[model samples]
Structure formats: C-alpha cells, structure tokens
Target: MSSSFRAPPIPSSDEIDLVALFQVIWKQKKLVLAATASAGLIAAIYAFLTPPQYEVSSVLRPAAINELDALNRSEIYTLPPGDALVRVGASLESYDTRLGFFRSNQKLFKAFEQPGRTLEQSFEEFNRNSIELILPDPKKANSLSAYIKLEMSYPKGVDGVAILNGFVDYAIATEREQIAADLDVIVKNRLNELKGKIDAARSNYEVDKEARIASLRETDSLRRAQLQDELKALRAQLKTGRIDRVAQLNEAIGIAKSLGIRKPSTPSALGESERNGSSSVMRTEINNQQIPLYFMGVEALEAERTVLMQRKSDDFTEGRIAQIAKELQLLQSNREIEVLNRRENEDLFLAGVQPVRAEEARLRNLSIDMSRLKLVTIDKQALEPLRPVKPQKALIILLGLILGGFVGAFIAVIRHLVKTRQSQPQSAALSMLSNSPTMVGSDTGLNKP
Candidate 1:
C-alpha cells in the first residue's frame, strides 16, 4: 500500500470543450462576421476608392560655403539679410506657404484654369487636406537651407499630379532662366558702360592736349603781329619833305629883294643853284631821318618777331609736341584697358566682400539647376511613407470592435442582473414584511414556537 501510487489523468485534446467554442461562435456568428466584414470592407473601400496621394518635392540649394561664412562675419546678418537664404526658410516651412502653394490663385488658374469653388469653399477644402509642403534638410552641406518639398492630391482618377508637376516645373524653370538671363545682361551692359567711359576719357585727354598747343601758338602769332604794327607806325612818322618849309624859304627871298640887293638875268641861274642846294639839303635831311626810322623799325620788328618766334618755335616744335603728346597719347591708348581693369577691380571687391551680390546670380543658377535651398543638404530624397496612410483600416476596426463589444457587454450585464432579481423571491417577501411588521395569531391562542 505504501508503494502504490495512482497516476494523474492525462487531458486529451479531443476532450477539450470545442463544442462550447462552436456554440459560442454559432450563436454570435452574424455579429462576428458582420463586425469583421464591415471593418475589412471599409478598409478595402478606403484603400481603393479613396484617392491616392501625389508627392511633389522641390529642392533648394544652400548658399555657397564661402558666401555663408562671409555673411556670418558681416554685421548685417545679425538681423538676417533681406535676401538671405534663411529668410526664405521660414516661408518654406510655413503651413500657409504650402496651402497657398496648392490653392493659391495663380496655381489654381494654372491647374484648373478656373475658380470653380467659392473662396471659402476652396479654402475649406485646402485646409481639409490634399496638400503637404515641407522644407527638408539638405544632404551635403550643414549650414544650408535648401530644399522645398511639396505634395498635392486630387481624387484618384484625376491627373492632378502630372498637371501640377508640369505647371510647377514650367513656372520654376521660366523664372530661373529669366533671372539668369537678366543677370547676364546686366553684367554685359556694365562692361559696355565701362568701355564707353574709357573711350570718352581718351578723347578728352587728346582734345585737351591739342587745345593747349593751339593756344600757345595763337599767343605767339599775336605777339608777332603787334610788333609789326609798331614798326609800321614808326616808319610813317620818319617821312621827310614838307610844303610849309618851301613856302617859308620863298618869303625870305622876297624880303631880301626888297632890301635892294640888285640882281641880273643870271638871278634865275642863281635861284636855280640855290633851289638845287635846298633840295639836296632836304634830301639829305630826309635820308638822315628815314634811314634810322627804317633801320630802327626793322631792328625792333626783328627783336619782337624773334622773341615771339622763339617762344612759338619752342612750343609748336614737332619734338616738343611729340613729347607732350606722348603722355596724352599713352593715356588714351591705355584708357580702355585701365577702365576695364578698374571695373574688374570693382567686381572683385564685391566678389571678395559682398560676394553674395556678385555670386547671387551664379548661386541662383546653381539653385535652379539644383534647387532653391540655402541650407546644407541633410537628405536628398523625400520621406517615402510606408503605406498610403489614408483610411487606416486596422484602427477603424479596433474602434468599431471596442464600441460594439462595449455595447454588447453592457446589455449582457444588464440582462444578467434582471435574471438574478427574478430568480430570488425572498427579496420581495422581505421588502413586504419590512414595510409592515405584523404578528400572526393561531387558533389555539397565542402560541410560542
């Protein structure tokens, strides 16, 4: 007896209460199937009938590293540049920007070419959901604020994605090309202006030189002419032989005759001889007066002319003109080159200091080629969602099931309480007895039990 021990009964799978489970399912089969099918159908419908989302991404490139560093050093960046890359960053991240991008008047016209809905209705739908816009981090550089990511959706079956993408691309490309071309034109015009200035400067230098030489020559000629006039006046004053002197001589002769100095017919010969002598004397006097005047005038004229000629000769000489012209000529010849260099130097100043202004165009082009981001590239590709993310069926089903089960359980509990109350009669009797406590007397009189 001490050695004997009974073996515990082994439970068989067949003996398990499968029937209970089957009964429970059969009793609630419609509920279970209905719940599950409703959930599944809703899920399928949401998946198939609901529109598929179209994700659109627009990229922006960060400002160049060197430019960013330079801007950082500048005092202006403390408040952020009006044209800074960061300024656009906020817009890129704003909900309004995204919303405006999708439902903006411009975009609306581009996409649908009409405003079918009222402003409120359009805004309502815009807010309700159909678009997602974001600015993703750049992939390569750290300090850049570069990319703009956008997504817009219409009901499934509409070509909204393709149409929207085409519009956006066209607009972006056109804007970028126009800006680039405009910048190129500005640079070319600036270069041409510099060239024109240089040409004008050269012309000024040459004209100024010629004017100076001409003035010097004219002054010299004027001096020479003045000296010649002085010489002409001096010669006119030196002329001899006067009619008054001859009249005085005849009067003296009549006086001598009245004094009775008798004369013969030879008086004519005498008079002739005397007249001849007078004429000779007059001629000698004239020679003496005019010779010195002519010689003196010639000498004075020579001196003045010599002085002026000396000065003029020195000033207008080919060698002298050549020497003076060399500087002007050199300046003129190099004017274009110098001006070009000066312009380049100015550009270099901007390129070195506010390179953003100069390189802004280059950066913009690069941005167009790449994107409008001024941020470092942290990631290149957009975040791809795992699923369509709309009409989450499992969640919907869970919610439904919980709600249904709770209702079912509440009804079941209430029913169980009602059944328990009906099965117990003591309560009603107890309640009645409580309400009226009375004594019952038997026929044998008051008897104690």
Candidate 2:
C-alpha cells in the first residue's frame, strides 16, 4: 500500500511574465516613489547651492601694416605685423605671464582666493582652468581666423570683463616692451662696436704719429751729421790752400831776390832798353814765351799771401757754405714733429673717416621712442556679462529627476524579484503535499480508527 506523488513542474528560467513583473512593481510603488522623491530633492538642493560662473571674452586682431611700419622700417630691428601679433599670442599663452599678472594685481583676483591654499596654488588653478585662448584651427581650410579670442570664466561676484581687458593691454604692452628692449640691445651692441673701431683707429693714428715724429728726428740727426762733416772738410781744404799759397809766395820772393828783379817783368819786357830817358823796345818779334810767377815783384806776392793768411773763416769765400748753414739750421727744429705733438684733435687727421662718420651718424639718429609702437589691437573688448554661464538650475533639476526615476525603478524590480523567489519553494512544497496518496490514506486510516 505505497503511494507515489510528484510536484507540479516549475516554470523555465527563460520564461518572463510581464504582467506579473508589473504587478510586483505596482505593489512596491510607494517605496519607489519615495526613493525618486529623495533623489530629486537632493539634486535640487545641490543645484541651488552651486555658485554661478560668468564668462567674459575678447577678440584680438592683427595690427595694420601702417601700425608696424615703424618697426619694419627701423634699421635696428625689422618685425612684420604677423610676427608682432604672433608674439602677443605667445605672451598670452605663457604661464609665467599669467602668474605675473595675477601676482601684480592681487586685488583683481581676490575672489579666486580659497582658504588653506596659497596664492600661487590658487593662481595655478586659475591659470589652468579659468583662462582660454581660442586660435584658428590649422587643420581646417576655412578656419583661418584673422583674430584670436580670449575668454575667461569667473565665479559670481568677480569682474571678469575688466580683468580680461587689462590683461589684453598688459600682454600687448609687455610684448612691446620686450621688442623695445631687443632693439635697444641691438643698438647698444652696434654702438659699442663702432666705438671700439673708433678707439682702434685713434690708437693706430697715435702710433703712426709717433713713428712719423721719430722718422723726422732721425732724418734731422742724419742731415745735421752730414752738414757738420761737409763743414769740417771745407775748413780743412781752406787751411791747406792758405798754407800752400804762402809757401809758393815765399819761394817766389826768394827767386825774385836771386834774380835781382824788384818789380814785375815779362821776357819781352827785359828786351826793352831806355835810350836818353826814353824807353825803346829792342824785342819786337812775336814769340810764345810764358811769364814766371817770380817775375812779379816780391812786394805784390807778399801782400797777397798776407791777405790769405789773415782770412779767419773760409765760409765767406764759398757761397755753398751759407746755403749749407741755412739747411742745417732748418733741420735743427723738426716743424712737422712739433705740429704733430701740438695737435689736440687727432680724429680729424685719421684716414678713411668719411664712411665711418656717416654710419655712426645714421645709427645715432636711429634712436626713437618704442612705447608708441603697437604690436596688436584689441578689436572687441570684453563686456560685463549679465547672465551667468554656468549652474543651470532647470537642467540640473530635470537630470536629477530622470536619474532618480531610474534608480527607483531598479529598486522596485529587485524587491519584486526577491519576493517572487522566496514564495516559489513554498508553493512547490504545498503542491507535493496535496498531491501525495500516502497522506490521503493516512487521513482515511485515522478516521477509521
């Protein structure tokens, strides 16, 4: 009398009953609504507490060619308009430039100050996030914008417009100053080079002048020595000539005494005879006969010799002596050397100075005020924005509501599935108990007993 009983077949795991799932959700709808309401309320609170951010932007256009002509035409430095604007853009992109601006104008950035953070740290954040520079996209063919856009997002209560404008002016001014400094450096270096050349020329001039003076002195010394030698030789010759003349006169005087001739007489004169106080010429024939020096009277020879011996200086006898004396006197003082030594301004005498002076004058005139130069222009200045750029309350509330609905729906589904699984084993056990024949027969026996 054994009884066989089987439980009802369980539904497949793949099977889904949409109506039942909805029913479970409907039963837990209150919990779902409460969760959704809670999420939505939190979202609203957060959106309301968050501060607003204001955005200010400005546009920078390239300066005109006329604006940069002054720089381009300068002899010191030539920078085109494109290069100038590029410099400005690079300055705006520099991190140090931004930080310097912030530090110098702390009053303008007070709103960015946060507790427990240093000024630098706060500036780091501001530099990284608050500022934006919009440039043309090179990848796109039509993206070539002739201007650059600078934008800044500041928290509420901040004057973003004024700061942006000031920064534009600051960047432009800084770049301009840098250009000026570069020009100054170039000019200064060139001027120093020119000065060095001038100094070198002056030094060379001095050296040449000294060399010339030395040459003049040497020439004078040589000429003076030559003149002295000539003077000595002339004096010696004059003395020798006087002694020879005196000797000749003495000999002539001796011969004249020996011959008993007291006066000058030629051979022809000896042939003349005086007849009765009248002189008669006995020798009238033509004959080539030389006259002897001793034929002159001793008185005349002695007189001439005495004159030669009495001569103190032979210089008066020679005209060349006077000329030599004059030349030697001139050589005694070198006029050229004296003039060179007395010269106060030596640059006037230097060679090849016309071109140098011209170049120097041009460089000197190249100096100009660089502050007036304009590198970039701010085409559009930033204005005070009336509306905040961030913290959209409506969008935040809507997103929060949608997110809460999803979370609440997920919770309800999980609760319904948990309840359904817990009741499944109980239902299977009840079906098995009711269907068992052994339990039915036991009940019958219990009734019979």
Candidate 3:
C-alpha cells in the first residue's frame, strides 16, 4: 500500500531560474527607469540651483626676521629668541583663537550671516563651512621652517578674498598686541626690581658709614682719657714743695763756695751763728734725701708723659687721623658713587620702562607694516577663486544612479517573493478541494443536484 502523504519537492540547482528573475525585472522596467530618472533629475536640479562656494587660501612661512628682533631694533622691550616665532605661529593657527576671531570679527561674520540668524548660529554655520587652518608636518612639527595654511570659503568670490585678507590682517594685529602687552609686563617688573636694588644698596651704605664713624669716635674718647690721666700726675708732682727746696739749697751752697769759703762751717756750741748754721745743715740733709726722690718721680713722670705723648701722636697723628679720615672719606665717596650709579641705573631702567607701552605700540605698528611689506613674508596671498570647490556634480550624479538601481532591484525582489508565497497557498487550497472524497450521490450533493 502506498503512503497517503507525499513530501514537498525541493528545487535543484538547475531549477534556480535566472530567466524568471530577468522577466520579473523586465516587468518592473518602468519603475526602475522612473526611479533612475527622478534621481538624476533631482541631482541635476541640486547641482544647478545650489550657490557655488568659492574658497581662497593663503600660505605663510615662519618669518625670517623675528618679531622680537624688530621690537628690539626699535629700542622697545627685548624678548628672548628661541621658539618665539614658533609659538606665535602656533597661536595664530590655534583652533580656539581662530574660532574666537571668527566669532568676534563683524566683517568676517557679515559674509556668512543670514536673515533672523543669531550671532551664535551664524558663527556655528560659518565655522562649519568657512575656515580651515592647516599646520606644518607632524614629523617636523617644531621646526622653524614650517608653514601655516589658512583657507576661507564663502558664497561670493570677492567676499572670500576680502574675508581672508581681513583675517590675516586681524591675526597680525592681535598677535602684535599680545606680544606688546607681555613686554610691558616684563619691562615694568624689571624696573621695579632695579629700583628695589638701588634702595637696598643705599640703605646698606648709610648703615656702614654710621657704624664706621661711631667706631672712630669711641676710639678717640678712650685715647684722650688715658692722656688726661698722665697729665694729672705730672701736675701733682710740680705742686709739691720738695722740688723747690732742693733747688734753693743747691744755689746757696754754690754761692758760699764762690765767696771763698773752703768748708761750709758746722755750727759750734755757744753762739747765734752756731744756731743758724746748725739749722742750715739740718735742712740741707732733709733736702738731699727728698731731692733724689722728687727728681726720680719727676723724671719718671716726664718720661711717661713723653712716652704717652709719643704713643698718642703715633696713634692719633695728623697724618694717621687724616689717613683714617681720608679712608673714611674715600669709602663714603665710593658708597656715594655706588648709590649714584645704582640710582642712575634705576632711573634709566625706569625711563626705559615709562615709555614701553608707547614704544611697544609704535614698534607693533611698525611690525605690522613690515609684515605687510613682506619683511615677514606672506608666501602666498589669497587669490579670488575661479571655481567653486563644492557641489561635486559628477560624483553626486554617479552616486544617485547607483542608489536608484539598488532601490529598484530591492522593490522588484520583494514583489516577486509576495507573488510566489500567494500562489503556493492558492495551489495547496485547490489540491485539498480536488482530493476531497466525492461520495456517489452524497446527501449534500444530491440536494445541490
């Protein structure tokens, strides 16, 4: 007995029909052509209607002569040499500075603004469409020989050129102002430092001079006191009567000898003459003992006085004191000169500082002019663009054509799949109806007949 169920037939490789696929695609040819033509037409219309955007670009090499050098030559503020040019160039190319420049400059924004647009919106649009800054090679990034490329795009060719030129001018001016402001700060700081040094030096010198004079005065007072003590001792010895008595006795003895008295008589026991002579002999004996003592004391005092005077003279001689005075004078003079020199330097530095702003302004203006004159060369100036750099018509058309074809193929395949599924259900329903048992004269059939 055969089984009642039959398995569904699987399509073999040979049954995979390319001809059917071609027929289906042919049947949908109009839809394909319509899609293709519509895409082409839309692309053509967009290419024709959209305003052309012209781009203007300029190239700048690092200035051969530095901006700082120009300022120095102008006798303004001096700047250190290495990497200043590189730093400035980098600043000019910075995204933030560039964005700020675009946002702030009324003229640059004027070309890109639309009606009812806010400043921020206009800036956003301009930033998106307009400016591009190209830096130097990554390998030689820090090299001084590197360049900066600036590009600007606008709907109008003239506007593009104008905006670019204006931007270049603005960048130079802004950079100049920034450098000058920095220089002003540096100059002012240096001036303050010099002034402080001058003041400190003057104070030190004054303190040193006062201390030296005080030392001299103290030494002089001590020496004077010693000399005064020696003088007092000599005066006390002169006021004593012993020295006078000795001198008078020596004179009397000499006188007696001159009057032909061979021996000075010693007094006898019984007379007035004896009494006077006895007193004289006694006084003479007392005088002889005290005279030597007085003389020794006087001699010693005189010798001491002489030594003291010599020492005082040596210690405080006119020449030595004068030498000290001269040395002090010289020291004071040198200090004065130093103070004066420092003061002068301070003044000069202040003088240099005072006009720094004006000088920087002047030099900055000169630098700007020099930059314009190609001293700091603009390697290439932006030219008016001859053609639009956007709205690439050929590429747009080709892409549209490819997209249309893909869309057309997708729609056709979907339609084919739906028709295949519907037919399968209908055929299965027909098989069921045809295979249904037909009883001979069934009740429902007989009623229908």
Candidate 4:
C-alpha cells in the first residue's frame, strides 16, 4: 500500500506575531519593577552610609641648593650632585624605610591612632593603603624635570594634610643624615690613606740617609789609612840610612878628583856628626889622609821628608779623598733639603686632614638635629581637601539603574518562555480531538460483523 506525507504549515505575514514579546513583558511588569526598585534602594543606602575618603598630595622638585653643593661650598669635601639627588629620592620613596620612620616617630601620627590598635598595626595599615610615591618617568630620570610626588589618603581632611607634611619633613631629615654619613666615610678614608703615604715617605728618607752616612764613613776611613801607610813607609826608608852610603861614595870621588886621582877608592873612615842622628854630615878619608867631606844624605833626607810632608798636605787639601768629602757633604745637604720639603708637605697634609675630620664630626653631630640641615624643599604643600573623593554617589546610582534594568528584562524573557511551553501541550491535544472522525458509524458496522 502507498503512503501519503504532508508538510507542516508555514505561517503567513499577518499570523507571524511580533507583539507576543511585548505581551510577555507586560505580564511580568510587576516583577521587573520590584527587582529594579530593590537594586536602586540598596545603591542609595550605600552611597549615604559609607564614610568618604580625602586625598592629600604634594610635589617635590630637587632643590637648587642641594646638600652636595652646600658641602662643596663649605670646602671640606666635594660630592657628586646627580648621584646624591637620586639617592635622596630613592631613600624617601623606600617603603620599609618610610614605615620605620613613622614607627619611630609615633607621636606625630598619634592623632590618627585608632583605639585598641597598636602603633605598629596602625602604621602597617596606613602604609599599605594610604601612602603613595609617584616617581619621575623612566626615560627622563636623569633630567632636571624629574620630580617626586607624594600622596596620602585619610578619612579626615585635616589628618591627610598633617600626615603628608610630617612625611615630607621626615624624608628630608633622613636624607640629610644619610648624606652626612657618606661624607664622613669618604673623608676619613682619604685622611687615613694620606697619613699612610706620609709615613712611608718619611721611613724611606730615613733609610736612605743612614745608608749614605755609612758609605761616606767607610770611604773616608779607607783613604786615611792609605795615606798613613805611605807616610810610615817613607819614615822607615829614612831610618835605614841607605842614603848615607851613596853620599859617602860621592865624597870619596870628589876628594880623589881634587887630588888629581883618576880612580877613586872606598873611604877608609867616615865620621858622623853628633848633632844629626843618622842624617848627619860625615867626613871621608882617602889614601890614608884625612879629607873633609860633606855627607849630603842628612840634608837630602831632610829635604825629601819636607817634600813628603808637602805632598801629604796637598793630598789632604786637593786629592780624591777631599773631593769625596765635599761631594758627600753636598749630597747630604741636598738630601736634607729634600727631607725637609717632604716633612713640610706632610705637615701641611696633616693640618688639612685635622680640619676635615673636625668638620666631618661637626656635620655628623648636626645631622642629629635635622633642623640644621634642609636637604629638600617641598615645592607644594598639601592643603585641606574641600570635598570627599570616594563613593562617587551619582555614578554609583546611575550604574545601579542600568544593571537593574538589564536583569529585569532577562527575568521577564524567562517567564514568558515557561508560560508558552505550558500552554502548547493543551492546544495540541484539543486540535487532534477535533480533527479525528466521529465514532457512531464505526460502532454500528462492527456490531453487524
């Protein structure tokens, strides 16, 4: 048997209902109004009841009269300007350091202290939420345009301003103390190094002086000993009377020649004068006759002794030994002058070091009283906030109205979909019953069979 199939009917333009969506929303209007009203009421209550916060801020530019410049002007020591300023800014912005400062000066912040809260706990809370440090742009960090901005928030307007001013004061004082410490370390180390150099120079000079003296003494002793040995040898030669023999021979020859003798023989007797010891004149006899002879040995020996003494004197006056002594004296004098100059320089350096140390100590003591040193100037002071900065009441209420409308629309759509599903089944059953054929004729035919 063949089966026939029919397609489901498509709706006409007029039957395709667009107004059903409006009808569904209209039916749930009460629910939408209730949700929106509830959200708006909650937002209004929050805006009215919540406490408002106030902000206090100040701008700080690097001061024209910096600590480093001040130190340089004082002439005690010089410090690098750029590095010093950067370090100062960094120290001021450091969280731990700032917190420590606040904790140490609890009396300053005591007005803000909450009941039943310890100072440490209060400081922790304040640091976490209230304090903010805005640094300069990274690209422009080295430029003079770089600056530090400090901001603080508090529940009360006056408290905000007071805390910010106190923070600024503390930061400046701390920076000065740090700079003074750095200067002290630098000056002390330089002073110690200079002292060491001076001591080493002095020690070297002393060692050189002693060596020069010892060398000169040894040279003088050797030369003097040589001259004494030569003198002694000459004395011994004169004492031996070797010069007498030659003189006696010469006298004999002279006497023989006077007697017309071609050959002269040895003198048989020679008489020595008692007046002169070995150098006395003597008479010689020739051919058994007494002949007066003058022995020139004594005179020659005496003259030779005089020449030796003159040479000895000349050696002492103009020889290498004298030259060596003069040269050594000159050298010693020059060395002494050099030593004196060095000592004078050392003394000057010592004098300079003393004042620098004293200045460093004075500065260090002054650092304890930060009022004496102002490292930074607050360019703008924090003023009392005129209006509350928190809650944003109008914005909050507007956002609540918008969000509530969207939530109400979504709930209405869901309700419409559920109601439509519940009515669809009943309509399908009623249409099926009306479309089926009547059962009366069918029952009569079945009973005849």
- Per-residue C-alpha lDDT of model 2 across residues 30-97, encoded as one tens digit per residue: 87788878888998999889998889999888888898787777766888777787889999999878
Please write out the lDDT profile of model 1 over residues 122-215, one tens digit for every residue: 5556545654555544565764444555565554344554544543444444433444465456556654655555555556655654575566
lDDT of candidate 3 at residue 303, scale 0 to 100:
46
- Clash-forming residue pairs, model 4: none
Query: Candidate 2, which segments miss by more than 4 Å at Cα?
Result: 1-37, 59-65, 78-86, 93-96, 114-125, 132-149, 267-292, 342-344, 438-449
Model 4 lDDT, residue 36, Cα: 81
lDDT of 2: 0.83
Q: What tens-digit string does per-residue lDDT give for candidate 4 at 100-204?
A: 778776776765679998877887787888888888778765756656788888774346776788777777767777767776776567657656665665576
Residue 431 local lDDT, model 3: 70
The candidate with the higher lDDT, 3 or 4, is 4
Give lDDT tens digits, candidate 3, residues 114-170. 899987787787767677888777876576566678888777533677677767766
Better lDDT candidate (2, 3): 2
Cα lDDT of candidate 3 equals 0.59
TM-score of candidate 2 on Cα atoms, chains taken together = 0.81
* Candidate 3 Cα outliers beyond 4 Å, as residue runs: 1-23, 65-82, 93-105, 114-121, 136-145, 241-377, 413-449
Q: What TM-score would each prediction reach against the true structure?
A: 0.41, 0.81, 0.58, 0.62
lDDT score, candidate 1, position 145: 45
